[model samples]
Target: MRPRYTVVASLSRLHRTFLTAPSSSDEGFDFIFYMTNKAKSINKALNDAVPLCNNPLVLKIHEAMRYTLLSGGKRVRPMLCLAACELVGGQESTAVPGACAVEMIHASSLIQDDLPCMDDDSLRRGKPTNHKVFGEDIAVLTADALIALAVKKLASSTSFGVSPERVLRAVLEMAKAVGTEGLVAGQAADLAGEGMSLEENEVGLKHLEFIHIHKTAALLEAAAVIGAIIGGGSDEEIERLRRYARCTGLMFQVVDDVLDVTKSSEELGKTAGKDLIAGKMTYPRVMGVEKSREYAEKLNREAREHLQGFDSNKVAPLLSLADYIVNRQN
Candidate 1:
């Protein structure tokens, strides 16, 4: 089938835009400053969205939800959603609901993923897995609650200034990212690949890409696309953001695989070298470490090319974000 969207501009035009130097104001743009401020904003919204002590009967599950959802991490997905919205000239307030919804979905996935039936991980984000702390049953329900609450937040929490149609579109994008076509599909493939013998090199690059694209990139794609939709970006503009998100999302997984080997347990805040021990299909495993690094660089470049036509100052956050993904130790 043909893709939903294709590049609207020629390669020359994209490269010229990519190579244009950032203006003086953008030169001084501080990633730490932006990240800190955005993280604070997101945290506040998330806290308000999923308030603890709401009801005595469900307090246990609520705790489990917040334990994982609010745990400190980079908050990359939500940040991307907000940044994409601003990139298209939308107010940050308009995107806050969508941003929080994406994070809830992301956190829900991690909770389920760390269960004994899945990755069987004991640690995540520098703490015990939700299932480990709250037991498997609560952890499962926690995932369910978060998914439902995420949709609720998206449908109800967005400002009335945004049209109902736009909010519905954003919710639809978020739903797609979580269902059979997105995270679940990628995870299922990943598990199936793990069941095969590690000695076999049949797990090729194409297969690896499929797994990562669906597993990791799917939600990230939704993040950017939903933001653009909420921000009222044109079809062509939304498509470009999707392309940028897809590249960075894949880069995220590739870099993660590399970090699994290169970083220590203390550094990564989780088990180090776990992927190698598990013999999971990864870019480093298939293409070798050096080639994987090269591939990461290529993906980063391709993602930046998609950002070319946008205002330079407006895109500084995303441009810095791409670089951050490549170089982040964890």
Candidate 2:
């Protein structure tokens, strides 16, 4: 079956049954809407929770940290974390801390990526880059603080009902995903690839895959895996979720590349054509645009297939999210 057909057919059916249901009472619909709304509200609450250090010495630093953390961005990774937790039968309240930690890490990465030494763009999520507003030194410091705080919060937020072992594993997985073996190495390679001529070597593709997978996919994979772990999923289920996350993460990047080339900066909430200007390697740069889109659709279908044994109601959000991943304009 064609990938688009496979994914859309199932998703369309699910949407018709769940998302399209006509509610007899606005109150009942409102409650369901509230539950979805709460998932997004938690990120705002966590961002606001970043302590305003009373120490005059660190107060400015804290402010800069809050500036970027509170900036509007889709809390997709954290949402995935919560969704994964629910899919594995954990309460959303119990998953909040882990979700927050993931968002903090994601926000920190954006700060660093926006630095002069990195992607060097001056806008993010439709606002001035952290470095532009706070100065590079403060922005760098803020990113560092967020990273440290993410670890500390994950370690300290034990009241959320995740077991000690599971919390430890989640923290370790997050650390690995963001560390040198993960995002950092990918970034280094991405930066190094600028101005280099493409030779179509399989080795080069492997390197590109490593960079994209780590830089974009590792944390996403970790989000799902950590959620499953915290939710008491069996090892087999966790592995299956990991596979789904991996595919979706890559699909996310492919769609991102497509959008970067096709969409506007205002639409993207970030600079468009930066990839082209920077000469960064991307899916569209490697595979033709049509082929990349096809690949992403294929991956989305495979990801949904991986969830087939689970109750459709439970996995509905994830499946919808996968479709959103490819279809989103931003």
Per model, how many backbone clashes are there?
Answer: 0, 0
Q: Per-residue lDDT tens digits of candidate 2, residues 1-330?
A: 332222233233333434444322233233334334644566556755687878988998888887777665556677788788888888877767777788788889999998999989898776788899889998888888888988877776467767898889888988998899778887888888776676743246676778788888888888888788787788888888888988899898989989899999865657898998997888888877899899988998899888887876577677767776766655
Candidate 1 error regions (>4 Å): 1-26, 198-203
In order, candidate lDDTs are: 0.83, 0.76
Check candidate 1 and list the clashing pairs. Answer: none
TM-score versus the correct structure, for each prediction: 0.90, 0.87
Model 1 C-alpha lDDT per residue in residues 101-164, reported as the tens digit of each score: 8999999999988889998999886678999999999999999999999898888744548889
Against the true structure, candidate 2 reaches a TM-score of 0.87
Per-candidate RMSD, Å: 9.1, 7.5
lDDT of 1 at 237: 88
Candidate 1 lowest-lDDT run of ten: 3-12
